[model samples]
Target: MDIDVNDSTPPAPEEYPDVDGEPPAWAEDRTPLGDAIPWFRKFQGGMHTKEGILYGLLISGDAGVRSYIDDEIIITRTGGSSERDAEGKLSQVADQKDDTAISRSVNNSMKFNIAVGVVIGKKNKILKRKLPHAFNVMDYFRVAYVWHERIDGFIAVRFRLEKLELEEKSWWAEKGSPAPPRTARRKWVKPIEHICGACAQTYYRIYMQGWMCLNTSCSQFWKLPDGNDPPVELDYDPKWLDWRHDPSDEVQPHYSLVPDFMSVIDDSDPNSTYSRTSWKNGIVCPSCKQCLSRRFWDGWRCDESCGFKRVLNMQTISLRAVVDDYEVAPIRRAIVFDPGPKETALIEPEIDDVYSHPYRRLVFDLPGAGTVTHFVTNREINAKPNGPNDLFIQLQQANLGLRRYPLSQAGMPYGFVVAVDSLPFSEACDPILRVMGRLTWATHEATDKQGVTALIPNELLALGYFEDMAINYHDDGEDTLGPTIASLSLGAMAHKSLRMKYKYYNGFTKGSKKLVHDDPVLEGCANRDWRLDLKQKLDNNELDWPAYEAEWWRTYKANKSGAAREAPPCIKTQLHHGDLVVMHGDGVQKYYEHQVELEKGGGAKLRYALTARHVLPAKIEPGQWPKGQFQLTKDQDYKGT
Candidate 1:
């Protein structure tokens, strides 16, 4: 066994020892792959032995054989057909793009190397892969050294694997896995290229891999290729493989809806108004007013936006709504009117009004619109008509005709937008806009004191209900929506209930106190900020502090009671015909979910609701209303005749 040895090889560095030598402390435990490295080395050593040298595994002599995956490896192709000899046999070359793509893909997958080593074990059974073919390692070859003057000269190895037979009874076929077969009988094979033999015309393989001829009159399974068609070429590109491969053994990173830049603290400053479990008061940039924390940036400037910087020892303030307020309401069977600004104020409910009257109703007299009854009769004599009666009628008719929103598409509450057919400020909608503005001005309850007006109703939703129809529980907590939501019920009475979400329900339960831990735990050195390390850890998917903190609080709260419980306290209310219901703060939406059930005392009668909201400016659809028109149309008189 006199095998040639490269005696000129450089010594392995002491700083970086092999797995067998004194391993680094970081490699405390040997992984399966690490354990396999010695076996690979042993195999390489054996290949150099006299008996082992017969398999052309070394580059020392002319015995080393390198096979190209592609027939045209040295030359690039220009859309040439698969070349063949006069024997009409398929060429033994792969498409260059495909060959390169597969090579890159195989190299990138660490599993491929591990799988090769694993299958080379004592059993030597073929291993199954999600790719088009299962495979088994048949041979191993490694070059010990190259005649080059490089430090720490390395060894490179290659494995020769043979594709295994596809099992017809395997779960892969039963599950309809996308892995294509390698070969097919001639009778079942069909041309994958554009032209269809039956149609003698170009056709797409869009419907299926074995697509039938696309002549509607002649479309039949008989015209389709047999299941024995040549195997579809496997695309080994990472992007391509990602679509076809099943991620049966991958660790997905955890994701939090909280902004990447945001982190939660266990405690708050004595003077700070950041309420327990509330985003009420937080450090915010003076310019754009986005949340500012130690994790994302220095001081108060959001690096991505307006570079507004400010020094803050520890100050917390509320951010203002970025969009204007708006709303709409339907009157009982008679008519729906946008009770202009003055009238809206007269009909507006007080801050804690729902507390006193579980179903309180109000009546007010507008200077020009006359006396109006809330939660009772819908009234309007003859003031400035809200808009052309014809327009309102058209909107109602359209509402009836529009299809019910599908549950699958219900990202938000399933509802329909009012036919603002005119500009958001047109005569038909201007009165509604003014009404919304008045409601906004009337809402004095400041969830956070940095800004006064929290409820802005700029978007109007005309929601319809069929007999026995009920709205599933959900919260309007989208970043785009304002703190307050106002609803005007019409036609029939409906029972509305607000319930705390399961995660936060305990907070509202009897004697359940909020979990508080406001300590300066995230320590930083004088020279280096530990917060930066936290951010890096978060970005690298190493830590999820926000989710961890939230879960910690939940567990703490649950354990405090010393009893296992699931639900928390819930608040319920009812919206009668012509009733006005207003949600005062964003807290309710963030902490709870609400549902509306149709009260069925009056048989199957239609119930309509006019819901209003202030959507963030960026969320408002472009062209729904011209820019700068919200305020402009407020003071403008309706010219609709």
Candidate 2:
């Protein structure tokens, strides 16, 4: 069909190929769509086929689609009044948004289509999506090109554009296997306007196409039409903005508890440290001492290091906690408190000294004044105020009350600031309580591979190492060698691996031994100021000098005996997820070597690893045992490998 999409009528380029004379190399053996396309003279050919064309086979999957084509209006169409319409009565009823009815019609045309097969109205929610590739759609009609779908349905189509057509298009859709009912042809509705109003400008209309501009400055806003309701707004004073949203002037940390010196944020969600005071304001992330500056993103910034960014504005609450009818929510008060109108630096209460503890004084600024808790003797929150012991009892009860929801949500009971409640500084221990419950061991051994088992230091406790004890597990009895360092867990688990390359070093040797004073092998080129290509790497730039030549020969003298025999080396691996393997205290790294390997299929689903290993500072002989990846040393003190 010679569709008039663009400028002028013209002959199809491939339909008139020079068979005798010689076809171009590209045109030789061209596929159906590829051969038909005239690529060389596109700007010229485009004059004729501005609107492209589409061809689709009536595969088994597409045969049934033609049945739903609406040649004319149906006989029994009705309106809301329940009055029936005959023949031409409902002829003008075209813009109804009911998707199912539209799907039943299966409307389409040769040039354009608006079929409501799957993505009916935009009301369908997508449970999941592939993001960048998710809503991928090809459309001839720009205004209606957006193909939204339900969680299950999908859409796909392809087209061939011609040069002659104005606003040219070429398209076709076919399924791989047989479909129940598919339509081939349907009426195409040409987009009369260049830009959809909702897209061109601001549109606040009840229903329309495209993502409308939400910015208030744009015109074309859809006014509240007849029989439509508007959003509700309450007359809140401007002061609430400072208290609820911006709290830089409100929160102050206690300086009484000496151990609690690190003045971190006190937001309920630690992950949400970047809860900015302003939602749309400009801000930037600053360099934080604790590397937590990026966490509190509030807004765009003129300069980075301001340490703020915005958090998502939405909050999710559990539904089952409320009444059956969720139409109304119980009265919950939100309060904004500013300790003083200071410009900046309102920190969570800190404790400078254990003796100067606030005692009963409210050290931290809480959202409400309802639940006053005391530290309980047990690991819980006590709400009663009889004494410090009473506080412990109250804390115990509080702990029992807080254990129901997902740990991510339940862990943060320093709930959003509410109008009437006073929570104290000791409440920092609230999270500490949860941490205590998770840690099974108060005292344990911290061992190094050198067979040195040091008492689990107080430093580990101060750094909150035991806070995640529930997750750190190892086995009862395990024998491990080098390559993978292995730790025997209290619960019968081994986290890392150790693969040892053993060579007997006896005091009595038959041959002349070299007592070299220095390592002859050159230092790694990485420290040298040179950029060499792959060629230089293969060249023997190392150990090629006369000095190294003698050193290398001496290193291998009389050292070949008693070396382990290599018979099918069935290597045992101990690679576990999130295992931290540390090289410690002794100067062993001064002699050993280490390297990391990226294993194929090592982690399929969620396995990601980062490694730090010991690289020998000393020279190793050529073709020595323990050469590559699994080389370890018998001496030297190098930590953090």
Candidate 3:
């Protein structure tokens, strides 16, 4: 799997691709191949290692240490900071530190004869030539030598890498030309080796000026002969820079530089199991051979417009079988009722009342926040045809145009984005209408006792999760949203948990970076006695909020580092098919965030979370408003059953 130069270019566009479609902005500059292929992926540092084994080297000319490529050899420096003195200034080169993890990995690779892939950054000045790509993937090489060197008054590790294949022509050279033969180039001589009398360490005379005891532990380290002062800076000896290693038997790489992308999954076999972890990795486009990240929900599409796309055809599974598989699990024998250290309790009906009604209700009242209510439905509610099972299958086959969107400027887009009314408001199909109706009923039931009016949901977000897919902790407290939000769980069983906001638990301001107050006397948070004392002071009006905040900072600074600790979940429960979870009150989202994790190793391969929210019409833009009238007919309304 050598990447040919032509493979990077996209194919020519069709004569009339699309009347309204603009040409795709194919990326010309090279970018990090992040999990696009198995062999090579993006890494942070100059060296890439896995489990203490060096796998690749990123050579850049802009590093602090000198690095260069000459013929078939690469001379690069290791990574680490110099030792600082008591005054915080860097120490002499002899006192520099070279014991970094990357340096150790380089030494390990040299000792183990591990072949490492080489990538050349465009900014490299060693070759004094511009590269065709920002990051050019070179062939693999073996760590030929490892040594310690002094650079800018600091000790640094250096590696000498030699190309594994000696007979192949170097890609950087002129077309059809191999490296200049040793006999054809200028004559070169090897540098003299010096033995240190003080430390008994062998040293190479690589400096242009002279040689000294290179060992840092020796008294004569960096000392020139006859007390001759060493140059303020050092330069490599031209003869040493020109030195080359003798040709050896060709060594093969353990893996190809570009792994086969088509083998990621058997696309032809629709019945095969597809784990989220396996399919989440990017794929190499078969047409342009460019590495593409898995950005879209449906499939991989080449951004270069090479006319290559792969959409996975996942089959709809039975929700009944999924519930059956979950019940068989060992952990399902007893329901999880973790009250956490703060004693936030989980309340449920007695055994007699549990199965009496159309649905069983469970509730957890969060401290200083609103309630989280779960309506556990009966088996009749989850039956086939117009039930959760039918809804799950229909949603899977619907053309909702669901996809993932980037939450921030960097990193991969995570979690499926909201799929709003894709059709006219008056024309929404049964599946969407069913979820909205159920959520509406649940929201009203959960909030009516509190004298809070329920808001009819205008938007529904249908998110699909494969094996191990999950939604991280986030709040639904948006200005445009109503106080209550409800969701319907379908397919595989999922575990949902709610936790106090970090700022609320730690009493620290997230944006201002200040210790503003003591903990809010929550049940599960740390420092209970301190929080209680503060609460008492506030109750008595002996201290106001500002005064208490100042006192808290003073007291906390004396014993703490002002670091925030993660708050544990106060409410946790499992959500099965036909389960309705209603989070009522603005305080719930304001004080807490929730997350949902799908059950792994299940009978159903997919789970769908259809959440409905009341989107205020005043907040929507004029152009974004729905075209048709929005109204739910009598038949679309759902009762408690």
Candidate 4:
């Protein structure tokens, strides 16, 4: 959970004046007899009183509080008598248990800053108190009534404190062009009522380095109080020039990932459709950065004779499609990484987080998406152990809503479920997180663009592709989706293809076409609740694999067409095991759709992919979803109707 600090000022006497000097106006008659307790004042209050105290704390510039309850609270179980000072205030308790309930409550109240003592063997040799730097002395705890549980924990007295020489003043002063007269003085930055840049409406304490404007209607970009200059653009290497052309599988090589199966038609034969110049307009090699021209049969060859060859299974093209010849774009769109080899071990280690799953692998892909990064995390889970080496296999299974989604004319090639802020950092996940951040920054040196910075991944998709399962063409064009999507492929080698959406060349003809467009909003779709039936059938042993395939095919054929209308052939790329694919550029997700399919004749029976995205903030809240333990849907970032 993100940390939220209270920063407000107390109201004036007239605004919430003490009625007859008894209490603040709102607290006068309405104050319950139970509320007379002093300790509970820190936590329980209505809207007005809550703001009142928060404002008081901020105006006083106090960074923290040193709370002291009655000695009875700490020494009750030990039968110790309470003592008092000359002022009649309860003295600090002498008899205290480290493991008592009171100790736990205090520790959990805030994210405390601490100084560790030297460790002697398994225990600390000494301990010392390390207070916040903004702490200053004040007495606000004298107003509470000293009662036991009836008064919400007896508070004998408490002290408010401010840190000496607070350092944030200079920073706040720099935000204003000419520091305002009121702001010129260095005291405390209270909950200032300022107008939002987007809607010109007043907001309370909503300025920060990584916070968005509080205006819900405006949807303005995130900006800091002082302002920020857009990032610099990445300079392109001269060697990575544009080399795209028309695509066709007729002259491309065909290879099987499992077996050494490759075939090339003899161009010398008179009946051959392709000759020595067949691959003149082929794409570049994904393995090596060389252009793969169509000169040989089977697969295209690198012009420099790099010897990089593979089946023309899928053409690797830019994230955005090349509608015409005048387009100048990046030669390569996705990147493939190699992590050497896998280690053979018994019971593969899986690290647990707060979520239902664990970190199944060690590869991460972080892509710079203008201002923030879109990161990928790969995790694997299984019901049963594949072998003795699979230590992370789960005997207890939890469903994270992974299911197939329907596209315009085809379905997603694999099962996928999007996770919203679900993955938490742990010992196993932290290393990858750190590495990805550094790698993304390194990549920005060559790919950075103005007005863009690396952002954290907000959504995760756990995708599974069974044998013969495949996803069709679909662009992630949801308004909530970010400009980039990064994915890490694991398990089996799968064919990931990106196809250009069909738009008529003639404006007049476009108006007459009735092409099917998948609704971007996925709320209330059949896929949401439909997956439960499939899961139930599988669990109950009532599903027949052969019958399932036959039924799916029947539905596929009836989905308005055997295939989506052809505009142009698709560009393909191979996602080998442990490869990372970062689809950059805002135009990419806007103009193109992609699919993941099982490579024909591949050795592995299943493939898995972990794809990460930055969903819009409006859709991340769970309260907007259906009332249930789990909600599964095909829609990407769909807001409820």
TM-score of every candidate: 0.30, 0.17, 0.77, 0.26
For model 4, the superposed segments whose C-alpha errors exceed 4 Å read 1-451, 504-565, 602-604, 622-641
Can you give the lDDT of residue 323 in candidate 2?
14
Model 1: runs farther than 4 Å from truth? 1-401, 406-451, 507-569, 618-641
Candidate 4 residue lDDT tens string, 376-466: 2222221122210121111002222333332101001212333222332221132233223322332332134334463445444555543
Residue 67 error, candidate 3, Å: 3.8
- Assess the local accuracy of residue 35 in candidate 3 as a C-alpha lDDT between 0 and 100: 56
Off by over 4 Å in 2: 1-308, 312-550, 553-641
Q: What is candidate 4's CA lDDT for residue 180?
A: 24
What is residue 107's positional error in candidate 1, in angstroms? 58
The candidate with the higher lDDT, 1 or 2, is 1
Each candidate's clash count: 9, 116, 3, 35
True lDDT of residue 153, candidate 4: 26
Give the backbone clash total of model 1.
9
User: With candidate 3 superimposed using the best TM-score fit, by how many Å does residue 230's alpha carbon deviate from the native?
Assistant: 6.7
Tens-place lDDT per residue, model 3, 374-468, is 88765666663577767878877766665543211100111223422344555566677777778888888877766888876666666777677
> How would you encode candidate 1's per-residue C-alpha lDDT over 197-290 as one tens digit per residue?
6557664342233444444333332243762422322122222111211223341211111122224333244122122112211243434433
The alpha-carbon lDDT assigned to residue 622 of candidate 4 equals: 53
